[model samples]
Each structure stands twice: as C-alpha cells, then as structure tokens.
Target chain A: MFVIKCPYCGERDQTEFSCHGESHIARPENPNEVNDKEWGEYLFFRSNPKGIHYERWTHDHGCRQWFNVKRHTVTDKIIQTYTMGESKPEDNNV
Target chain B: MKYSLLNLVRNSFSYHENWQEAWSSPELKKEYDIIIVGGGGHGLGTAYYLAKEFGLKNIAVLEKGWIGGGNTGRNTTIIRSNYLWDESAALYNHAVNLWEGLSSELNYNVMFSQRGLFHLAHTVHDMQEITRRGYSNHLNGIDAEILDKEQVLKKIPYINGDGRYPIMGALLQRRGGTARHDAVAWGYARAAENLGVDIIQNCEVKGINITNGTVTGLETTRGSVKAKKVGLVPAGHSSVLANMAGFHLPINSVPLQALVSEPIKPILDCVIMSNAVHVYVSQSDKGEIVVGAGSDAYNSYSQRGSFDMIEHIMGPLVELFPIFSRLKMLRQWGGIVDVTPDRSPIIGKTPVENLFINCGWGTGGFKATPGSAHTFAETVATGEPSKMAAPFSIDRHYSGALVDEAAAAAVAH
Candidate 1:
C-alpha cells in the first residue's frame, strides 16, 4: 500500500484516492473532422507503458480533487504528484 | 513418453528413477511456418491445435521465461462456461467441451474435476441479474439452474447463508469446476512437441520485424528468427508487444491476486463465487482453500497487489464461509492481466498483416484456454478470423459491436 501525496491535500492513504487511468489524453479538437480510425485510436488505444507512467488520480475521500501521479509501473513507486494541469515530470530518475 | 498404466507399472520396477523430460527445449530455428510468442497454456495449446488440427508443421513456441510461469500458473484454476452473451457463451462453452476430453487426448492427467460452480446472489438486484443470465445460458445450450437460499445451504452445508448479506439464491452450472493448471501447460507442451513443434525457453522478444505493414518475424534476445505467420498470445504484455510492432492495443495491464490457505481436510467440494463481494473460493485437490480477489484499481506490472485488497476480500470470504476465518493463508501472488474496456477477449487478426493476437482475456482467461487456442489457431492459419473468433476482432472496438461480458459474467472484473 502507498501513502499517496495528493496535490490538494497532504499525505493520505491510497484507499482514499481512485485512479482514473492514463492521464494527458487530449480529446481530438475537431471530432467531426477526424477519420474513424483516428477517432477510434483516440477513444480506445492506450500506451499502457510497463515502465514509467503518468496517470490521473482523485483524492475521492479526502480533498475530493483530481491530480496526476508519475509512478513506475513495474516497481509501483510514485515519483511525483502534481496538480492536473502541470506537465509530466521530465526527470527519469525516481 | 506416453503416460499410461503400462509405463507407470514398468517404471515402478526401477523405483521410478528414470523419467524423461516432459518437453524438449530446442534451439531457436532460423525460420518456421508459424510462431507463438508466449509459452503459457494458450500459446502452447495454440501450437498443439495448429499441428493436430490444422496439419501445420515447423511451429515454435517462444517463452521469455519458463513455460506456464506466467498467468497460466498464477491463476486459481477455476473453469466455468456460464457466460451470458451469445458470443461468449459459444466461445467459453466450446472450451468446456474441449476440457472434458483434454486429459485423454493429451495422454496426461489434468485432473479436471466437474464439481458444480455456484454464483451466490446476495441482493435482489444480484438475484435478478443471475436469473437473467441463467436463462441466457440455457438458451445457449449451456447447463444452468437457479437455486434458492435453502438449496445453496443444503449443498454447501457449512456456508453462512444468513450472514451480513443474506444469500437469496444462486446460479449453478453443474459442468463447471477446476483443473490442474500446471498440467494443462505441460500436457500441451509435450503433446505439441510430439507433433513436431519446437518449444524454446528464455527467448525474450525484443522487436517484431515488419516490412511494408507485413510481419516477417521477431527479433529476440536469443537471436532473430523468421516466420511466415506469428501469433502474439502474451498475457498482460500485449500492449508492450503491440507497441514494438508499431500498433497500439486497447489493453491495460493490471495486477490480480489469488491466495491459498494452508492445507486441511477436504471440506469444500464445489466452487462458490460471490460477485457482489468480489470474492471466490474453492478447495484445491490438496485441500488448500484457494481464494481469488478483485484487481487493484491502478494499472501495474509488478505482479503484486496492495495488502488492503486481501483485507477487503477476507471480510466477505469469512462472512460467507465462517469456518475459514481461522485458516492461515499459505501463499499469495499476483498476475498481470491485460484487460479490455468491454471485459472480453480479443482473438483475431491485427493491423499488421500475418500477425494475429489472442489476448485481453483479463480476469477470466484460464477457463477459455482450449477454445481460445482452438479458434486462434484457425485464425492464424487461414489469415482470417474464425467464425467463433470473428465477433472478438479488434475492429469491434471501432464498430461498437462489442460482446460486453462485464455486465453479465458471474465473476467480478
């Protein structure tokens, strides 16, 4: 279990948060202009990387706010926790 | 070596000291007619059917690690085919049929026990859902019967039907049961090898060689090998492999955990699953009470789950089977499952030509091993989706023709 650091609140138990899957997936700007294949890719396909991953998490029980977490998929080690609009962490080191 | 009474009796004379290897670990070939990427039950079974059914020769099953060491070994070995959707009903029931004769056909004792399976309904909503699915299973020609609380208590006498969540009724599938999971992999490995299929271990795939949108072969750690057709059957790592081939899959790898309690006297005879509580329990042949828990919310490839998941399931598990409250857990482990949005498997051609994929079985894959391989072998051989596999094609994601089993399947995803 992890003591996740929510951006809105301080350190909190992992159970208080809910993961919302891969983050930073920008919906296509013009949905009507995109082809079916492109729209489908945007809708269904995910990177789901095995190493470093950036995903969304909500402090559902605590602050009730959403944020992003940079964590290692293989190690389950959280590298950083930033608010929703921040860019993904640039450093590779944990 | 064909396992038989004669062989057992003859070997007994020498104190059973001389036993041949179940399968030969062959060196990677330069090229082959077909190649299977993972050496789990599905991949080995696919190779077995490719040789036995399709008359295909010169096939190789490449394993990154030892055979059956992945989800094939990690799963709790529960086998049932009472799915609600027509497509899933046909696919999973086909597996149940193949499972019946699997031991005899493989010439190995898989120990497939046809003990009945019960999906207990704890609420009125769960009762309605299961009754609807029970009727659907009957329509699909699969055996199913709804039993009231009293019947459930009579069959499973030790169950706590009047616990915190009272059991209203249950959907029972008499043909559903458990099997020896490791034997399933070894049986298929030996049988496939006997049919002239090579089994290569410790060969990790680094890249998929493609030219002009067509698959040529794979570049592995051992060496690059060529193949006319390749089937990507790797569980949990489907997205990773697809990315190597310049395509993406709608799969997320997550950890699902299962644990077994210390051995005791044989007390439980049937599999009991409570979908609302996210717990399933069955007694293994060795008397260990095997328990399955729900997946963790976040994606992971760590092959381990949070401790809270165990705590969460144990509450309802003890509530359902009060006698198990004092039993000590023996071992706990996790397997990365490649889950799809619709909670159904994907078994058909991919965007890359000559490359087929059989993945996204998620939490309920072990039950469909034979059928998944049987239909997948046909798909890879003919370079077209088999009739049974056509409904589960990757195209369905775009076309919105998904066989949504998450809603109706007894086991919670």
Candidate 2:
C-alpha cells in the first residue's frame, strides 16, 4: 500500500487511488492509419517494469483528480506524484 | 518481531469519521481491563478470542452503529488467499483456515462456504502473475491450480470468450469462497455479547481523553468510559478518530462503489476477474450478480453510485459476461474504505499506552478478518505483533520500510 503524496490532498492510501498505466503513451494522431494490432497494443499493453515507471494516478478518495506520477514499480515508492494535466514525463529520470 | 513496529503502525491511522460510540458510561464502571471499539467483526472477534483463548474477560466492544454496519456489511462478501507475497499469503491462508472452522467455533452457522475462486486473466502477463501468485500461495500451504480457457468455459459456459479481451488462462483455488456478511457480523456480535463483553451500540465516541502521553479513557455519546486498553476498528472512518487523538495517520479515506445486477439465474460459480477490464464478478447466494470496480480517484463521502463508474465497470463485465448486458441494474451502493499507503492493512497497536488500532483494511480487510482479529487481539493483550504482521507495521512507512503491495493489492487480487 504505497502512500502517495497527492499534490492536492496530503498523502493517501494506495486504495484511495487509481493507477493509469504508462503515463506517456500518446494516442496516434491518425487513428485510421494505425492498424488493428497497433491500436490494440496501445490500448492493452503497459510497461509493468520492475524499475521506475511513469504513470497517471487519481486521488479517488480525496481530490477525485487525475495526476501524473513517477513511481518505482519494484519498491512501490512514489518518486514524484503530481496532478493529471502535467506535461509528458522525461524518461531520463526514470 | 520488533514490538515497536506494531505500536507504530497505528500512527498512520486513517480514521475519518467522528468517534461516535453509541455506548459509554463512566460512572457505571470506572475502568475495564480492555476496550475494543467498532463492534464489527474484528472488535467482536477480538473479544471472543480474548475470553476463549487468552482466558481474559471483562472486555467491552463499542459501536457507533449496529454491528457489521460498516464495511463488514457493505463489502461484496468474497474471500480468497491467493497472494504473490509471503507475508500476505500466509496471513490470508490462516484466515481461510479459521473460516473453515468458524461455523463450529461460533456454534452458529455463519453461512461459510468454500465454493472456490477463479482469477481470470486476459494477457500472458496476467497469467504469469497468477502463476507466480499460485506458486507463492501454494508454498504457503494453499491449494491452487492453473486453468486454461477450455477449463474456464467448462466451469461456467456463460462467460464470454472472444479474442478481444480473450481468456488466456486462470488461477483456480478450490479453498477460497464467501460467507454471509451480516450473519458473520451478527454471529460474532451475539457470541461476543453473550460472553459478557459489553456490545454497546448506538454509542458515539467524541474524543480520547489522554494525559501525559497515556490513554486514560474516551468521551463518547453516552458518557465517559475509562479503560486500560482500547482498540479502534472504525474502518473508513478510522482517520477522523485517530485525528482526535493527535495521531498523524498517512491513510486517506475513499468511497469504494459496488453494484449488482437484478437477480438472475446463478451463472457464475467461482469468482471471475478480468485483468484487462479491471472488473470482477461473482453471483451471491441470493442470485444477485455482485460486481466491483477500482476506486475512482478522489475524496467524497457520497454513496451515490456514479454513471461513469457503471460505464467503466460495465465495459469489463459485458466483455467477460455477455449475459450481464441484458441484466437490469439492481441496487448499487458505496462504502468508505480506509486505505493504507501500501494496499495492506495496518492492524496493530498505537504509540500511546493502552491505545490499540485496527483500521486500514482497504479492500483487503474482509478476506483477512479471522487472522487480523486473532493477531490483533494477541497484540492488544500482549503489546506485541505476531510474526505474520511484523512486515506491515506503520513505523515501516516512516523508516522507508513500507511493504510494496502493488503486485499484491492490484484489482487482480
């Protein structure tokens, strides 16, 4: 149960939170151009990397706002937990 | 195990509701040897064990509302022990063991059943995780097996099996199942009440009267009550009660919503979970298809089941159980869950003397009732945590020793 430090609400339990997978997966601008496989992969595949992972988080129990978070997958540590509208994460930090 | 860890975990006491115990009277008995708050399963179960196992009586259980009125009654009423981690695996297995014998132990039918639980997986990764968890739980003495799509189809033909959100594989456990939620609570309540523990209801606790860093007693709706020991089991409302005592709890409260389709023929035998959809389903004994979704990120005390939640949960349900699309939506409700930073529950003592806590069940609380209550009672009586709970102490969070339960607490659980 990682205690996420929501920027809006103080630290909250992992249960009062939702994890939106792989924060930087942008949808292809041309939907018709992407094949069915690519679309499915984009929708289904997520990096459950053992190391640092960029993800979107929602403080469901407190603010009800979605935020971007740079979290460690292996250690369950929140490197940086921020709100939803943040810019795409820099992969170098991960 | 470090005794300090048990005492410290209560520090992240995510108590959000007012301490409104419907039963309290200072003048009647100045002080009892022990006090257990929140007369739900854990509190009452603690008293029962204290008297039967520890040879201790004179216990009091105070509840603001009727027994099992909290998450105990609100939960979807399912139980399983397939876990990836060692600490949680053993603990839940022990709880399942207790459930096997609980009907005879309580001498009242709690409607306990071992109808089996099947974890549905859509992708190879989910199947691998299930395999990992299956091995872990098996090593911890749980009975688990792997099932392919053909086996799943054989078990319940009603489940949809298209390549879209296809069924890659599953983790089947014959030992895990559900019981009557209200009956389980009432069984514990009546049994504990009969054992001479003051099962006080309609009593609200307002404040914990302390002095010099010691828990003297508590001021409640009825009156002041003194006690040598106090345990809080307020569930989602756990944080607010902790605040009155000046405890800095790290947990936040969230409303977890669940809905049921109108009564249909019982199609699902074992529990069903969709890793791709993040939705799980199981039909109750009453024929209502109980479905739950992950919590919506945000804080609101409201219990109104959202349209968005239905839409989000339904997408997974229809993909998995096509029959559910036509089933009329029945009653939908929400319960406040006291979630901990690490998806695991904080079930131990507090820093203050004579003050013990058992909040932070999150979504994992119901599956852990027997073991949690057993070890929690042991801790409150002896002021030490059991080996099973040593890893989940609240102090670990402060010391960067938090138990990462992302793999364990995922909706796949």
Candidate 3:
C-alpha cells in the first residue's frame, strides 16, 4: 500500500485512498430526457489520448471528496491538482 | 398445577425470562437463518444491513478465511458515481450519498475521506470524452470539469510537462474519495455482531444444502447450517460457489495486483488514474504511495501478485511521474477479482428460489459497496430485484441487457 497525501489529511497509505477516474466530466439531468442516440454515445465513447491529458477522478478511499488532477502520460508526473470550480489550464501546444 | 405455574410466570409480566441456550462448541454449531457466502465487503456489509435493515435475525456470514480478508479488504478502496451508464450511474450516485453518511449511519467509523480523483487524458479525442461524460454526470447530479495544461501543472506540479502525449485536458470529479478497507470491514463486522449476526470466519462452504434445485442450507467446514434464504456474496470465488449450486455464472476470476512505495513525506494529494498508462497512483495518509494496475491476463485464484504487473507498470508510471523513480518499493501483492462480461456487478436473484447472489464484482466493485449491499439485501429479503440495481442482474446476460460502461468519456478510458 502506497502512502497518498490527502489535500485535507496528511500523507497516508494508498490503502487509505481510492482513485476516481479521469476527472472533470459533467452528467446530464434526466437520462430519459436524453435520446437513445445520445445515451449510446455517452456509453461507448472516451478520449484515449496518447500524451499529456486531462480527466476527472475521486479518492474513494481517502477524503471521500472528488477533486481534479492533471497528470502526464509519458511521465506520470501529476502536473496539476485542483478542486472543482477552478479554471482550466490555458491551452498549451504539448 | 403445571398450567397454573405457566400462568404464574405469564402473570409475572413485569420481568422477562432469561432462557439462554448455551452451545457446545464452535465447530459443532450449525444452523442459521441466513447463510451468506463470501466475506468481502459486500458479504459482510450484506450481513450488517440484513440484520440492521431487514431485521433478518439468526444470520451467519460464512467466510472461507477471515473477514475482509478477500477483495473486500484487498482492493484499492476508491468510490465514485461518475459512471456513464444510467442504470449504474444512478445507483452509484446513491452509493456516494451513503458513503457520505455511512460513518454516522452505522454508528461505526468507516473513515470515508473524499479527496477527489483526476483521470488524465493524453489526446484530443479524450477531451471530447470528458465533455460527453460530463454531460452524463450532470444528468445524474454529479459534476466533472475539464482541466487544461497550466491548471493541471498548478495542482500537480511534479510532471515532466513536456506533454509528449499532447496533454489536452481531463475530466474532474470533485467529490470522489477513499476509505480504509480494513476499517470498513471491521466496522461492519462489529456492528453486525452487535445485532446478533454470526460472522463465522475460517468456515468454508464445502457443499450446497439444497432441496430440489432450491437451497435449504449448506454444509460448511464447520458443520451443517440450515437456512431458509441464502446469498452468495463471494466475489472472486463466485463462479466456484455458483458451480456448487449446479448453475453456471458468466464470471472469470482474475488476479489483480497492486504495490506501494515505502513511507515518504507525501508528494501527491489527489488520486491519479490513466487508461493510457494503465497505472493508477495515489498517496495515502501514512505516506506510502499505493500504485495499482489492471489484472493479469491469466485466469486463476492465486493471491500472489506477480512482479510482471509491477515491472510492466514502471514504464507508464514513471512516464507519468518521474520522481517516483527515487522511491523505494515496500510491498506488492495480488487479489482475485471476479470479472463479468460487461464489467458490471451481478447483484440480484438467481434461478434458484431463496438463493440470492451478489457476485460478479469485477475490478470496480469496491466503490459500489453501499449500493451493492442496499440492493442485494432487498433482493434477498423480499426475493425481488431492485430497479436501481436491476441492470446488474445475472439475468441480463441471458436477456441481452448488458450495462456496458465503456463510454461515459471519463471512466476507464
């Protein structure tokens, strides 16, 4: 078990935390309101980028709160970590 | 005179009689109202809820080993409701709600800490996924954001930042978090015990006690336990237990592994997951960096997590976070995961009457603990499936109603 630092709690084991998926995606209201075409699109599509990328995640085992993180694909270096409502990073030519 | 004596005791209604029946031995004691298989979080949690919610007294949770000793205790303890599928998203959203109140609701400490999680994207198409998934999440009342380079660097800051993979942006869930797996199990066990539920550890179900395709009880390593209702909550061993009942489930047990770095002053705060890298990383409160990846491509119940997974992950892991190279490896191990065709859980009734199942929890079961238990319990007590959890039923495979979570833009992408 690796030690993960909680933005709220101090550094703890990875066992004490859970990883949410790629961060920062919004859901629609009333799934029935959305057409089957949209629903199918929502279920089958994902951006499997190759380099540096952005996504949403949650620490299910840690603070139990959802947050955002920016990480690199080639290096795995977490470039940025932010709470919701934070502005997105400026577009950069990677 | 005997009748008069009986009436005299009845007349003494002011006090209740302590007619306690003592048992001979733990090994010899058998016979329970409910015999639940599997000791993972779902099984133990089911036992807790059955007694607490449904008032199903005389319940026994039979674990082959110890409580929480299975995947319920071994997984990367994360929870979220950002699923792309409505059947799953709605249910998991409810699970997040329960996780919010479980500590106080159970009157036991679950230590559910919501630290948020960020899934990194490395391409342009990934951005579109984030947008689409974000829409679905909003529909389910969950929020996810798209983050760009500077913002990503500002929060994480330890990246190579070269963006060789064209780090476009990410889907962010601000409410997801983790909890202690062991504590989660212990809390439920202690609570279930207090409610008179028997947690029989080290007891394996050797034989199925069934009557004409319907389960009457079970013959375990300890002894025979007769129950009117049964629930097979075993995750990895789900197929095995299902075989015992003369039925087949579409589940394969795969070995999933994870490793941790030695304790160091924390560097990362938020949990990081990358489908491109196929390695997920997060730092715990104790300073160890827990790292995990997908299951081994082989089929086996072996609990020995192979070095192949760890060594293979280094390429992506280091690529994402170069500084981890300096970190020392502490421990590495594997847990058996029950995989389904659609990567969804099987949490409803089987063809066998009175024999309910809550298995088929593939790689992503830990997050679905509360919701799995809530619906599974309802299925067992009432012999009816829950609408919220119905999509995950075993019947779906036969009926062709699969809940594929492949889309949702941000999940497992």
Q: What digit string (tens of lDDT, one per residue) describes model 1 on residues B1-413? A: 78888999999998988878888888998999999999999999999999999999999999999999999999989999999899999999999999999999999888999999999999999999999999999999999999999999999989998888999999999999999999999999999999999999999999999999999999999999999999999998999999999889988899899999999999999999998876898999999999997898788999998888899878989999889999999899999999998899999998899999999999989999999999999999899999999999998888878888876664554
Local distance difference test values of all predictions, in order? 0.92, 0.73, 0.72
| TM-score for chain B of each model, two decimals | 0.99, 0.90, 0.90
Selected candidate, larger TM-score, 1 vs 2: 1
Order candidates by lDDT, high to low: 1, 2, 3
Q: Of the candidates shown, which would achieve the greatest lDDT relative to the real structure? A: 1
Span of ten consecutive residues with least summed lDDT in model 2 chain B: B19-28
Instruction: State the lDDT of candidate 2 residue by residue for B204-305, as single tens digits.
Output: 788998888888888888789898888888886676678777774556555677888888776777777665678878888889998887774443334443
Question: Model 3, residue B217: displacement in angstroms?
Answer: 0.6
Each prediction's DockQ against the real complex: 0.83, 0.04, 0.02
Q: Give Cα distance to truth, residue B230, candidate 2, Å.
A: 0.4
Q: Residue B180 lDDT in model 1?
A: 95
* Candidate 1 stretches greater than 4 Å from native: B410-413
Q: State the lDDT of candidate 3 residue by residue for B1-413, as single tens digits.
A: 11235755875684635422211113424577787887777887888888889988888888898888888777777777777778888878888888899887766668788888877777767667667777888887897877886777788868655644745666778788788888777777777777787778888988887788789988888878788999999877876777688776766566688888899996887877776556778888888888888775434566754444677666677878888888888888778777666777788887788999988777888888888888788788888887876778776765568887743433332
lDDT of 2: 0.73
Model 2 TM-score, all chains together: 0.76
Residue B278 CA error for candidate 1 (Å)?
Answer: 1.6
